[model samples]
Target: MRILLTNDDGIQAHGLRVLYKAFREAGHDVHCVAPVTEQSAVGHAVTIALPLRVKEFKENGFRGHGVYGTPVDCVKLALSALLYEKPDLVVSGINAGANVGVDLLYSGTVSAATEGAFMGFPALAISYDDFNHEGLTGEHGSYVANLVERLPLDNLPHKCVLNLNFPNRPVAECRELRICRHTSAMWEDWYDQRHDPRGRPYYWLTGVIPPEKVSADTDRALLTAGHVTLTPLRFDFTDYDLIQSLGGSLE
Candidate 1:
């Protein structure tokens, strides 16, 4: 299968490079178009007011185009201008951090795959639970590539995204992949206010979901339990039940 590979962790990220090699060795044609620098948590932002720049990167037999813009921008630019043909699949990440629950709302990693789905292609976003890259290896990428090679891409619903998250442990240690749902839980977020050299206050964002809030059968809980989690997501944002109730009342 032809694949468009991208990530929010920048083009030169180890996880992205590992995935590139894995896909190539698996015999799937892969193209990498990703951010020139880390663009994590930027969500689905696009460069509307500024001209985007693309630079080709080739090193140690790995090649990819790096975009000086958001992860979503790379996918849009690649499909609209770079590639000679549309890809069969758009895969993002092998991200350093997990994208689960509300993290998906603020994740550039998942947003990249979401952009690919918007273009009517089968898309996937892969992430690891560990942020510091502890215990990560090529086997994780190979495992995911093997799964992608077997997925029924042609039959996937339009505008659907398969969000895959692997546990921090090695592939051999993971309890098989489990299909799950994202939790509706919100993060207990807070801002850390501090002073700069000039005595100006700056706020740094930090948060976590309380353990009691995560339930079993959801992506977060399963991943914490050392299982790979796959959650199918759709772009349709309509609250149909609410819409139906207010349909004629507002009319």
Candidate 2:
């Protein structure tokens, strides 16, 4: 299958390089168009006013492009300008950190794949839970790459995107992948107030310690237990149940 790869991390990220190599080695036609600089937490934002730039290159026997825009811009440009035809699939990430819980709201990685889904393509956003985890070299990248190659794309739901999160453990220690739900979790926020050398006030954002809830089916809980969590995400955010309860109040 022809796969278009992208990430929130910049074009030079180790995660992107490793995943690109793996896709090539697996004999799939892979094309890349990622941000020129890191665009993490930019959400599903696209470049609207400014002109976008695309730079084509070849590295490690893989042909790819770099985009001077957000992750959503990369997807839009690849579909409209770069590829002669739409790719079979769009895969985003191998991200630097996990996009779980409400964090998905701010993830550029998820946004890229979500953009593809909006355009009627199968999309996936893969991330590792560890922030400091390095590239998919030797066994690490290979294992995840192989699993991705074998994913049951043919049976995927329509208008849905997959959000995959792997445990932070070594590849060998990883258990089987688990289909799970997005955790009903949220960050306990805090701020550190301080004065600068000139006595100006500033605040540094921070979070309180996360507590383990009793839920048996959350992406975080699964990952914490060494499972690869696969959560199917949909664009529809409506509260349908509530809508029915308030049916036609004026009537």
Candidate 3:
């Protein structure tokens, strides 16, 4: 398959390099177009007003393009102008952190894959379940490469994007991949007030997931259990039932 790889973590992230190597070794043609800087939580944003810049992104012997904008912008440019030939699949990450539960609402990694799907391509948003990488390497990259190789891509729903999360455990220890649901959970949010050297106050947003609310079938729950989770996602955000419920009630 000809694959177009991208990430919110920028074109130079280790995860992208690992995925690039694994895919090449698996005999697939791959190209990358990603943010020049990390755009992690900037979900689905597009650069419309400001003129976007594009430059060559190269590191550790790999070559790709870097866009001075959001992850969605990179994929949009790739499908619309960057790649010489359209990719058969768009793989948006091996992101630094998992995009599960309500976190999906603010994930640029997921949004990149979503943009690909919206452009009518089969896509995947992949990530590691652990945020602390203390011991990750390219050695385990094949686990993801093989998953893509074995997936029934032709069987997926039209314009569907899959969100895949690998557990923090060793790749060899990774258990069966399971189809799962995003957790119906919310972050316990708080802002940390801090002072600068000049005595100015600044607040940094911080939050945590309430573990007790995590259910058995959610991607977060499965990832916590050492299973790789695959959640099929769609770009459509319509709440049809609610739309019907309020259709005739409003004046």
Candidate 4:
């Protein structure tokens, strides 16, 4: 299969490199186009005014393009300009950290794959829950790559993408994958006020992420229980039910 790889973390990230190697070793033709710098929290924004720059880089037997833009821009350019033919699938990440719940609204990794999904292709966004590289290795990368290969892309909903989050456990301990729903969770905090060297006020946003109340089949609950969570995400944010109810009230 021909796969287009991308990520929110820049092209040089270890996570991207490891996954690229695993995909190539699996005999699939893989092409990568990622941001030149980390584009985390950028969501699904595409460049509108300024021109995007794409530069080529060769490393670890994988040739890739680094775009001086957001993760969404990288995927857009790859499909429209870079690749001569349409890829069978678009896979974003092996990202450095998990993208779950309300956090998906700010995740460039998920946004990159969503861009592909909007263009009529099966797209996936895979992330490792932990930010630390304690036990991360080629074997772990291979395991995730295999899981991506086994996904039922042929039966997925139109213009929808799979948002996958793996546990921080060792690859050998990765037991089962669960089809789950995104948790209705959110971060709660305010900025900390501090003084600069010149006695000016500055604020640093820092706080703990409080856990949400778990409902049945939530991605957060499944991930906390050590299962790999696969949530089918759609680009449409419309509340159709609300619209219908409002129409009756307005009339």
Candidate 5:
């Protein structure tokens, strides 16, 4: 497959580079156009107000274009103008953190794949549950690349994107892949108020979705149980049932 790889973790991220090597070794023509700096949690933001810059990054036989914008911008720019040909598959991530539960609402990793799906292409978003990248190896990337190769992606519905998350455990220790649903669990977050050297208060956000609230067989729940989770997501925001009821009452 001709693959377009991108990430929210920037072009130089270890996860992205690992995937790049694995994909190249797998014999897929891979082109990466990613953010020059980390754009995690930026969601589907675009760079409309300012001109976006594209820079080429070549180091140690790895080549990719880095965009000074959001993950969505990289996909949009690459598909619309940067690449000479449309890719057969648009793959985002191998992201450092899992984008499950409410995290999907603010995840640049998932949003990158979402943008590709919005543009009528098959897309997949890959993420790991761990934020720490220590003790990682190319095997993780190989595991992801192998899964991508084996998935029946061509059979996916139009405008659908798959969100895949792996548990923090090593690939060998992780359980079998489970097709799952995204959890509707909410984040129980709190902002920490701290004083700067000047005595000004600044707040830092930190939170977690209570494990008790996560439903069984959902992405978050399964991933926590050391299982790889795959959730097929669609972008339609229409609440048809509500529309019908509201139309009848208002009319």
Candidate 6:
């Protein structure tokens, strides 16, 4: 299968590099086009008015293209220009941090794969829940490689993308891959106010998940308990249930 690899953690991220090698070793053709800088929470944004640049990416002998734009731009350009043909699958991540629950709405890693899904291709978005970066090339990498190689890449379910998050535990400590729903997670956005030397005000954004928002059986909570989580994501944002329940009040 021709697998396209991308990430929000720029082109030279350790997570991306490990996957590149692992996937190739597993006998799949891999291509990469990723943001040239860290784009962690950029979400599903795409470059429109700005002139995007694409250049050769080379580091530690791995070669791919680097896009000077968002993760969605990388996916768009790679499909339209870089690859000779449409890929069998588009895989995003091995991201620097877990993109679970509400992070789904703010993750560029998932956005790249989401863009691929919008373009009518099968996509997978994965992340290691640990932020310490110790598991980039260990069990987490192997688990992802195996999952990709075994997937029905040519015939994925239509109009949905898979979101996978692995726990921060060791390989042997992992319980199982649990197919689950997203947790009702919310971040209490906090700002650290500061002033520049010249007296201009600034604020650093910070977030803390409230205890009330924590649920027992969500991807986010399950992952912390040593289970890998897989959730199916859909793009249809319509509140159809509400619409259906609301009877016609006026013509």
**C-alpha TM-score for every candidate:** 0.96, 0.91, 0.95, 0.93, 0.97, 0.93
Runs off by more than 4 Å, candidate 6 = 244-251
* Local distance difference test values of all predictions, in order: 0.92, 0.83, 0.87, 0.86, 0.91, 0.86
Model 3: residues >4 Å from true position, as ranges? none
Clashing pairs in 1: none
lDDT of model 2 at residue 108?
A: 95
Q: Please provide, for model 1 over 13-122, each residue's C-alpha lDDT reduced to its tens digit, 9 standing for 90 to 100.
A: 88898899999999989999999999998998999999999999988989899999999999999999999989999999889999999687899999999999999899
Model 5 Cα lDDT, one tens digit per residue, 186-232: 99999999999999999999998999999987999999999989999
User: So what's the TM-score on candidate 4?
Assistant: 0.93
Looking at candidate 2, the ten consecutive residues that score lowest on lDDT are 207-216
Best by lDDT: 1
Instruction: Give every collision pair in model 6.
Output: none
Q: What lDDT is obtained when candidate 2 is compared to the true structure? A: 0.83
Better of 5 and 6 by TM-score: 5
Give me the runs in candidate 5 sitting further than 4 Å from their true place: none
Candidate 4, residues 1-251, lDDT tens digits: the string is: 89999999899888888888898889889999999998888888889999999899986576999999999999999999999989989999878778888777789999999899998899999888887645567886787678767888788899989988888887778758888889886767799999999999999986545665666588877887888888998867799999999999999
lDDT of 6 by residue, 1-251 (tens): 78899999999888888888888878888899998998999999988999899889776668999999999999999999889988988999889788888787899989888999989899999888777676666556678888876767667677678999878767678889888999887878989999999999999998876656778688888888889898988877888877866655432
Candidate numbers sorted by TM-score from highest down: 5, 1, 3, 4, 6, 2
What TM-score does prediction 2 earn? Answer: 0.91
Candidate 2, residues 205-229, lDDT tens digits: the string is 8773275652668888888888888
Name the Cα RMSD for model 2.
2.1
